[model samples]
Target: MSAATTAAGAATADEELRWLADGRRIEAIEAISVSAMARRLPALVVRAFRLGWRIDRGAVGLLLTCQAVSAVLGAAGLFATTGTISALFGPGRVEDKLAHAAPSILVIAAAAGARSLLGITIRTVTIHLSPRISRAAEAEVLRATVAAELTAYDHAGYNDELEAADRGAEVCVDIVGEAQNLLASLASLLGAAGVLTVLHPALLPLLVIAALPQGIASVHAARVQFLANRATIGDRRIMANLRWYIHVKRNADQVRSDTMGEFLLAKYDQVGRRLDASSRRAAMQSARVSVIGAAASGLGGAVVWAAMLWLVSTGRMSLPRGGAAVFALTAVGTSLRGIVGYGADLFRTGMYLDDWSSFLDTAGGHRLERGTETPGAPRRIAVENLGYAYPASDRKVLDGVNLHVERGEILALVGENGSGKTTLAKLLAGLYLPDAGTVRWDGRDTRDLDPHALWRQVAVAPQDYARWPLTCRENITLGQPTAEGDAAVLRAADASGAADVVARLRRGLSTLLAVEWMGGEELSGGQWQRLAIARAFHREAGLLVLDEPTAALDPRAEHRIFQNLRAVARERAVVLVTHRLTNVAVADRIVVLEDGKVLQEGTFAELVAEEGGRFRELWDLQNERTGVPARRTRQDQRTVPDQRTRKDQRTLPVREDEGSGR
Candidate 1:
């Protein structure tokens, strides 16, 4: 097959892989090999240290110093205890032995007290540092997520990756703690080993032998758990979304209306059971490994005891020195096991941290196109043979399509659902860079101009406009907050029919818009649409793209919006994508799209005059449904009366019955 075909196939496979990740089944992530993990451990440690250090350098340094000094104190305490034991058991008078042992006992006490103080200091520093590190990491993740291109949200893989990364960020503070503990444990283990070597050089080798089995087992167990977690991340993300849909206030009504409580509850139970079963299996495997490790450790301890007895019997070692060696050997073994356990924990935490790092790379790779040149408002915007496909999809949504819009012209794009009209509009608005064409603003390629600068000249009202849960004023002035209460804000609100909507509010423009909030009110669908249009209008850009702007409006409100289109277009270009054919009748130009291609383009009258055309067929169909005559003269195009009065606007009033809210 050709290279394009191969790429398309790869994309299809990737999409299929994502499709399988719906929390219904376990799909294991490819496991990292032991060798690979070993190689990556050093890098992960360095990264973790840097992550912690960046948030609070002083605290990290202090924490490290405390751990190092505490380890040294630990070794000193072991040595002091050994000396005290030897002195007490030596052949001498009671008073002499007591005098000899007293100094060593004091040293032991001082070392122990110092270690305890250092431990307290470490805890204090860590407590202050964790939240700061967590916040910083969280901020980085949020920044990367928000700055990513809009197209990334369309793919399940991207969202799953982001969710995984978000989860990792949440636990990053804990990972830092784990790293610190791991280092501290390593120091303790080394201190014990040093004391063991001092007591008897032969005993140090026995400590290593005793720890080998448990170390292997701990690492193996960690790997098993890590694999389980990695495999379940996508499922966990799906579960989170489902839980949100069931419990969040916004989705409550839909859940009740559709009787989805039982269905969603069943889904929850099903996923939960699968996860529980997976957890049980992983836990069983780890337990088995631990048992085997315990057995090996007991056998190693027995061997060391046997060797010590043989040395004592042969008189090769003194009884007092041998007893100290045995004690040091036991301490070394315990500490070594703790170090291994901490190492396992660090490996697990490091893997999760890797998710955060991987997500940053993944999201950052698909950055918004950036350029150095700033662009001015365009007199003409043109698309040349545009072709585009969504991420991880084989089929192109727009293909070989060309179009143009200029100042003072209203271009109406009318097409059926899934006909690429919205996609074309996004390309025109510079929200997306075309895969196989150029969008030019005033004869200059938009790719060469800064995207932020280019977007300033364009304003868009998307079909599914966000209903921000803020004050009405804030929502309307979102794009032009600095122009709030200015003549322009009011003018845009008036032009979009939002001024009348705002007039009916209890608190007027300052009223919050979320029904779930105290003293807040919800707007009717049409009113919200009007507010979205107001937001777009507030931008006062040179190019305006309205996608189904009046879909929820009543006949009169819809008519009022189209009636003002000529005035709105007089100062800037307008691209209107709508299914309402009646609204298209007044456009200066009409473009017809079918199956990702431009089927026809002309004046509305010219298109209607043709006997056979997609535009005419759609117009005829709409006329039949509405029972309205087409080709109406200018005198016949009068605005309809306001069919929807005050009651139609779902505004809150200060009356007792209305709960004194808006």
Candidate 2:
């Protein structure tokens, strides 16, 4: 009793903590909290450096080379200036000759050309590598998401994952910038030191004292800025979502009818105000950091300039050389500033880099593997006592669930909300694993079978299907288990409803999608659902599990499509999940489910004929609700098997039955 009480207390505490962390606004505020910003700087910088080396290899090499050239160019520009001063003083005989203007022109031209070429080359290299790096990062993330178990996706908000993906897409740009700046800064700093060494080796110590403090302070400042940005992400996304709702056509009428414009604007203002506060804090922190940096620069420049003034007064740095020393001092200041700027950028990019790195490092989800062998058609599938719960759930969603599917028959699964109908369908489709039960194909554990092989024979149109913003031809081919060749896409599109869609599309199969960016127009919800079905049809798999396949379809369309599906199911086994009982009569057998357990199973005629059974209650309720006659005389209500005499186990949903079914 004591142990149980302790466990309950712990659970209560955990729930409270989770509730505290859950709100979009509250979570965003906490995420970007800057209290420990300084602590993460070193890690962030390190992560940015690693991404440069890993994803943008060519850009990174070019960055290093650019740094070297920039240093050389700085030295040359210094040399050219020195040559000018020498020409005035006749200190070097070469400078006296160059006083004729020809040599001076060549020196100026060389310095200008080197600087221009370095900038152009670095930009070109970074741009050239950006696409490849972006593609690789996106691919890695997609692969990870697909391979991971389904639970992760269910809990993560759509906006959160999308933002993460956007960050992944920008990883290349951040990587290139992080690397180029670091190299450029280092080069500039070294050139500054070299020029200062020539000016007066004694003053170098003061320069170091001034520059190093700012570099360290800049790193700390960057951390605070990143934290502030994080704190605003949640609230920012909410405002963005609100804006989307207001602007979208479907929601426009609803918004106006409900007078939601002011509500949305208020929500936006609330988030925006918090964001403004966070931004103000960040700006203040930045101002403080800047003031410190400026003070250090002023003190260092003053010491160097004062020393130069002293030398000039003492005839050490002559009038012309003293001017040169001042130029070098200015260059040193800019170089020190560059070093701090680069260090700060590198530090900030580190956080983005770590996310990108972790995302890319992930592999093995929903990826094509060599181990998958070609699977042939299965005669039967049996699920024996299959049970599962999600990763973070304490309650078992599917407890002692058992099911079976035979070749060439339709099975209808009926259940209340959250009764594990969809979960069972996913398990049967091999998209999920059974925690304690065995899923066998012809009595062999499916674990031994290759997943790719299994997928080739199965097609599942999920409860929530992806409406890819792609061409009509591409959409249907996605239904296929494998990537189809161009010719196959053409053929698949022809069979599905996509051919009609293609005709309407100005560019047909090549048309791009999205009003935000390209040539394609948005599809209607009903149209999108049809397109999704077409994708499944194109795949031509033997096993099909459809959850609310006609949920978005009009009644006439839904009725026709199911008729078409029954005709198409001639050579396949279909598992259908739906809330409506109208089509339940079409299945070979009906399985009644409630609270995640199968309450009873039988043909519609067999189950409905029984007194007060769950199926009878549901059936009676549906017919009564629709005012449909209980007795049926038409042949349209039943399915007859083909001439081949297997068992009368012929699966067609029956509205009224004489009790002759499997």
Candidate 3:
């Protein structure tokens, strides 16, 4: 209703757009928003009560005091009117009654004008500050999200938590703005109550009693909605996913390929139908709450109205007082109903703020602590009896697995697609911690080491590269910062063999990744993979772990990259996880994995020399698949075999004794 209230909702959509840019379900939003609101509630309430003081607290107080004085003057003017009527027939009224009444009426008019101006000025201030609140709240969401550990996102409830947090952040402005309006309404209700008290004190208690049931119902309705939001959070996400499947560009190919475009459409329709049904049910319940509350308030007003007419008939009250009494009761009754409605609105919004606060409370465990020591020398990363269970899974992916990498040496970790090679790499890089045993950096446990600090010295080309929507420049720069311009980016691009891809873009390095916003063409998977390799190269960390890094490249391009890797490895320990033995032939040492442990380790010559090892088996399979001979000679392996010695994987044991988290 006021300018201040209007401002809170105006810039909200833009603020939410910035939020949506993070991801489909923003993990950081809740910690940022609701937590701060919960902390600020007391202050907000205090501000609400003193809200009218914005133009000048003293000036507003002076204005209100004058209005009170003017109302008293108007009551005196009423007495003047009554006396002037009786005096027309006899000497019942005071002299100059009309002239005295005129000044009282004029003072009332002047006070009313001052109050209007104060209201407008206060409204303007509120409108101006609304964006500040929204942005501040939104900033908190971003801070908490980015600050959280990557692994915390593995949980399913986090998906719901994230959406709820955004909802809370979006609705918080409405809550506070409406709260201010509610307070103003409360003031009017107070004035109306005082007027009613003067007219008939007997009806005052009855009106309050009549309002209680509705007030309770309003609060109950708010709780119901909050619970519904909590319950349907899963359904809402499913609906969103289905809706995207049927409409979003990314899912279009799959939906059509299965020719279940209509089936996907039907699923979307089903989810939509359920959502509609739920919303309608909630609306009906809310309407019932409102209706019952309204009836009670109307009854209270009717009681007061009936009493006034009776009092007038009994010659105990004047007609003018009776009319004033009617206005007072009706206004007070409506205000009662409004107060209940506003209270419900506030209650629901309070939960949103609660959701925000609760999310923030969870931020500390996820973000890296600032004071952790950075590793002095990049050392061998060892997985000792390492075992992992997926979040909420009963079975282990990497059970009692032992693996080791020495400093400045390449270790080729090989396994079948689902045999946990990538998972082991993630554990080694500190993206994930083993459920049991240790992934130690030099003899120091990874849990004791700060992940952020470790990440500074480690670069990983994950199974999937993060395809940032920013320009190719921003995308690569995200892996590292400080350098800018096409020249710096081109160098990194060239190193990762992505320079040609960048050269083909319309704006080259400056072109945006997405086709929707900035006018730039998109790259294919192979091209994006090259960009990812450039990003990893740009990181320039002491430890480089590439998972299937050469999957998208041709044999010739792959060979060229392997040459680049040998030069890069002089300063850093390189771990290549790949199925292509032909590509891994360039590694300084090769570690072959079967199930989750190392089956054998040696130089390519030595491992190939062993007649019965897993490396030889894979080599033969690749040779057969590629139409090349991987024929091995016993004399070729003789001296190399003498140089290599290894241990069994069966001796590794599991351990999980540690504090959960602070």
In candidate 1, stretches whose alpha carbon ends up further than 4 angstroms from where it belongs are 1-42, 392-394, 483-487, 504-506, 517-519, 626-662
Q: Give the per-residue lDDT of model 2 (tens digit) for 493-559.
A: 4543445666687777666556544546777777677777767766767788888888887887677
**On a 0 to 1 TM-score scale, where does candidate 1 land against the true structure?**
0.85
By lDDT, rank the candidates, best first: 1, 2, 3
TM-score of each candidate structure, all chains considered together: 0.85, 0.75, 0.78
Ranking of predictions according to TM-score = 1, 3, 2
- Residue pairs with backbone atoms closer than 3 Å in model 1 (clashes): none
lDDT for model 1, please: 0.80
Worst 10 residues of 3 by lDDT: 16-25
The residue-by-residue lDDT of candidate 1 on 45-105, one tens digit each, is: 6777788888878888888888889888888888887898799889999999999999989
Worst 10 residues of 2 by lDDT: 15-24
Ten contiguous residues with the weakest lDDT in model 1: 16-25
Top candidate on lDDT is 1
The Cα local distance difference test for each model comes to 0.80, 0.68, 0.68
On TM-score, the stronger of 1 and 2 is: 1
Reference-based lDDT, residue 222, model 1 = 84
lDDT of 3 at 627: 68
